[model samples]
Target: MKGNAELLARTDMIVAAGGGERDVAVDAAILTNKPKSANPEAFLNERLMSDLRPTLFLAQLSNLLAGNISIVHGVTGSSRTFMGEEAAGVDAVRVALARIEAGQSELALVGGSHNGEREDLLLLYDAGGHMLHAPFQPVWERRSGMVLGSLGAFLVLEARGHAEARNAKPLARLARVLSERSARPPGAVSAALTRMWQTLTPHGARAGMAVISGATGAQPATNEERAWLKSLAEVPVRATGSRVGHGLEPQFSMNIALATLALGREKLFPPADSSGVEREYEGPLERVAVTAVGHWRGEGMALVEAVT
Candidate 1:
């Protein structure tokens, strides 16, 4: 469905960004004058050449948002920009769904964008104690940290015969997109989310299963992903950072596009957490399991369904 000559010679673009916003008053005047600079490293390179802004290092250059999305959505064939923040949006949709399932590209434009009202990204997540100044809970009833949200998530991944040869109508079915990186140690992010949830549900979690948690309520990785989501008994979990508030690298492609719009509206949207780990599902919402647990490192999982 990428017209404009397949978005200029076959669309492909992966981007999960960072290194793009800072200059909160030139980082608060170089942390209030770089330790009373008597020559503190040449006054921090003369306040980084007169207090920044030679286009602010070419606008912070994290591939300049894939070079401005290949110049305003002309999606120039092959492009990537994954920086390690929320595992660069889970390996930019697991390398654009593994380069369209190994044929090596057949339309893609993964996702990412965040600007959570940056005061230098809330002073780099409040210097790792990880923001969230309390009182506005609901990321599994928080009590830990994180609460940054400003988003722009994309998806448009194609190649079910290139989206049925362009007639296109796939709102879901990115069957699997797993990833891991755990040196976390104490039950390491719930054993790397139980080995990527038994390698994305190996005959488990059925019956209209639901989950759309990019659970960034921080701390011990959201309490080890709420203890591996209490083994999914009665599934129904939803923590799009408790209603859109943790956009770290576009929060796992914005919770896999909010679990493909709640499996294309078959349901599953209430329960903004009265702490039952999100419940109140009125049932029948086909398969959707999108979890990314990167409060301080990456661990991903995906398994959206219902494209039928």
Candidate 2:
């Protein structure tokens, strides 16, 4: 009865939820009705500790989301949680796919959720110079960087045999998913993407496939991914952040879900900008290569292909 039984439900299963930031409790000091002291920073730690219930601290257990889902939805399956900004979500999918392909799992649910509006999260990101300021710009064009976005996404993955047993019609096939982490020197990201692209290209010609990039409007990383994309054969490329903003942990799942839809419909969505990096595709859509480049770490790619 996992709350998401509508998508995936079983007495035995594995569920993974990837998250960049797990909770919004860091801003508890500002939420208090009490007046701010001249030096609130002096007693910030004490005040926050006193305000929170004994059972709950400012550091929220990222797994509570899975717990809640189990409680509400009745999914009594084994669960795992990972936290590492953008890479977490990508790994979640990678693990689920591995399990299925290895005959370790028949069906599973995996994804992530994000709340971009939290003041505390915003403050932290702003401190890092990651927040995009006013005067809107697409992810590629934004000089100030990523605009946070709230998003929740999940995917139901089933093995071919399991799917055939249930007579379920899959919209698309996950041909391959690969994830890697880079030490992140200036050119490291581009090199990583090129290596990943090579792995995804053997499935078919580079010209027939489109790319759905999880390029958050963030710096160095976005530009690096852009450069890597330029080195590839010219194909229709879409920067999802331009339309959905940046959803961090859930970005990989969100982009994969959207790419699946595009593959199912056999069409590409409208491009978000006129950067010439993304252009129109005239052929029937057959596959999409989804890319996820983290703001600070993690690089991943998924090859989604049409089954029929």
Candidate 3:
């Protein structure tokens, strides 16, 4: 909220976004009663007004977050919201960066958030075979099991001159953002990442550069991403979901932010597993590849370079 009122208004285009697991608590409260009827949609419409407290769809719809930010922040320039969970977060930053590169927006704000601690969401993910049932484990350590996380994140972007004029130093430079939805049919996700790596790998990816991954420990996708990462060999990788739990919508933005933090710190965070998958490098931390693999249907990567 402070960001909406303060930082967002200072920008030329505000791209505040995020939607996965945003309103599960409200949804869980409303859809509590199971209909005995075969037609769930019919049951919802028929008993909608009578059973629920005057139709609380406003509380459940995801766009309310964006609208609220506008009303509170006075960011009246242009607004857009993207939905579809992890991919939504990826697209938000992608669009913002595109607009900036096009010179359409000099000052911009972009990021995402997720409130993941809800029974309904956990059940939904579990039903889809995406939730972790066992004790907490590092993302790469467990083949299955995604512990949901509650988180919010945002970033302020400005053109080089805009920042220099204001004397605001940047933490890191976002070289490029590449996001895509994969029609994943075995091996497709890995193939997509490999292709993007070919495009995004600036000079040649070095052991000094690292990967900040958004693998949510969900089945084949997670396993697939791990295999692709291992193929890079010697490039240290950190699975963000392992430490933050899985904040579906905000996961990508959070990873990018963490990557910038590491770039500034000039060191990678310690590995989260003993599985020997995450290795260390003595080389200086320079570039970071931020990855986001959707639980169901998206794969993306972002390149962040150290300012030096």
Top candidate on lDDT is 1
Per-residue lDDT of candidate 1, residues 1-308 (tens digit): 33476456578888888877767777677878888988778888888888788776786889888888788767788888888888889888998889789989888888878888978678778998988896888877777998888888888888898778757788888989898896788888898888888888887857898878888888989988898888886888888877779988878887888788888988878878886777788989998888888888888888889887
How far residue 28's Cα lies from its native spot in candidate 2, in Å, is 6.5
Superposed on all Cα atoms, the candidates' RMSDs to the truth, in angstroms, are 13.6, 3.7, 3.5
Q: How would the candidate models be sorted by lDDT, starting from the highest? A: 1, 3, 2
1 or 3, which is superior by TM-score? 3
All models: lDDT? 0.83, 0.78, 0.79
TM-score of 2: 0.87
Off by over 4 Å in 3: 1-56
lDDT per residue as tens, model 2, 161-266: 7788778788789888999986898898899988888888866487568999999877798888888878765788999889878888888988999999998888
What is the Cα-based lDDT of residue 190 in candidate 3? 94
Report the lDDT tens digits of candidate 3 across residue range 162-253.
77876888998988989887679999989989888888984674757899999989988998998899888878888988787888878888
Clashing residue pairs in candidate 3 (N, C-alpha, C atoms within 3 angstroms): 132-145, 132-146
TM-score of each: 0.40, 0.87, 0.87
After superposition, candidate 2 runs with Cα above 4 Å error: 1-50, 53-59
Question: How many backbone collisions does model 3 have?
Answer: 2
